[model samples]
Target: MNRYAVIDIGGKQLRVEPGRFYDVRHFTSLQEISRSDVNIKVSINRVLLICHGSEISIGQPWLNDAVVKGRLLHPCFGKKIVIQKIHSKKKKRRSFGYREQLTRFVVDSICLNGRDLKDS
Candidate 1:
């Protein structure tokens, strides 16, 4: 079976796998860095995908130096949830809806070839 690293983002846990797309929660502007910067930067460790059976121990947001290579497919939005509130006598009605923005990414692989993923 194919396995990929799962990460926690936007208060949600995501499992990333090859040739698969996932809808992860929106990240802050600081986390939206270029691929090049993400490769070199270590402090910006919030989400990472590491291979299984690897000698790696990842902390919250940091995957012990593991890295997940993925491709951006597109931004997609889920169905909007409708909310309605009404008062019988006051004749006041409120309607609202909300939908979250998500980023679609296809996980390529989790590896430590370029970077050390564990305390090896």
Candidate 2:
């Protein structure tokens, strides 16, 4: 079985595994930082749970001295969702759509117990 972690970001919980990319809610400042640098290291301290090999650690809210490292893969908008409205009397219709911007990240490592292991 592969190791994985459950992390909280922007009040949303996500299941993340190393070496995989995920599209998450966008942070405005992240775009500014990424503009200067193509890739940057991101450390998330809101790790709710970590499962490594046979070891498992759960936090009351968040574990102390524990973090998850990731690489920023860039920012992009997700698929659009459309909405439509119609007026029966006028026989008129309108349609619009919205797309959520997301930041892409690849979970690099999950650190616990004062040790680090790079994802394979």
Candidate 3:
């Protein structure tokens, strides 16, 4: 069975699975850890939901006993977004591009009440 969870990070909600990589907005805490150049474990407590096998758990706002564990891989950038603007009969044109700073995170395990679902 596959195990997964919905977690909140950087004001955004993400559905993550174990052994997979995800790019999320850069966090100040992650920035501090990345400087050490070591394997740093990150625990997220804002778990909205969890699914393991045939069982499911939901939280009211967040589950206090549920936690998602992962590793901060590295810093990266999101896809570039191009913006263009033009004025009618004014011959005025403007263009811009933007890329959001992001961090790569790999989900290692999901724990509920001190029990890791990946082991089972």
Candidate 4:
């Protein structure tokens, strides 16, 4: 049997396992984050993974009984959306398209002391 760790991201819990991938929901849309007047840096780099017995730090390679590792692959796009505006009196129309941003990740491995943390 295999063990996994639970991680919290975007107000949700994710079950992380070695050699597996998980798609987390995006907190902010691409258009919203990109067009903000205020300058902000979107930190979508790494996540913390902890298991029942031990914890894993993202920077260093460390795994406990239930440890896992993952990396941010890329930002995925959602379905195409269109916004339209029309004026009856002037007979004018406007249209716009948009797509949401989604992220992808791949589990590296659960290791401790430079060794795989197999189920005990």
Which has the greatest lDDT? 3
Candidate 3: Cα lDDT at 120: 53
Query: Which consecutive 10 residues in model 4 have the weakest lDDT in total?
Result: 36-45
List lDDT for all candidates, in order. Answer: 0.58, 0.81, 0.86, 0.55
State each model's C-alpha RMSD to the native: 6.2, 2.6, 1.8, 9.8
lDDT of 3 by residue, 1-120 (tens): 867999989989999999999999855564454445645678998899999988999999899899899888877789999999999799999999999888888999999999888645
lDDT of 4 by residue, 8-116 (tens): 5677756777677666665443333333232222332223454434643442322233334556555567788899999989999999998866666667665544566
Off by over 4 Å in 2: 28-36, 87-92, 117-120
lDDT for 73 (candidate 1)? 56
* Position 80, candidate 2: lDDT: 99
Model 1 lDDT per residue over 1-120, tens place: 435566765677776665576766665544454434422212124555555554444556565555666655556678798999999899999999999766656666555546533322
- lDDT at 2, model 3: 68
Clashing pairs in 1: none
Candidate 2 per-residue lDDT, tens place, 12-89, comes to 989899889899885534545444565677888888998877778898998887888988878768999899999999
Instruction: Report the Cα lDDT for candidate 4.
Output: 0.55
* TM-score, one value per model: 0.61, 0.82, 0.90, 0.44
> What lDDT is reached at residue 76 by model 1?
64
Question: What is the TM-score of candidate 1?
Answer: 0.61
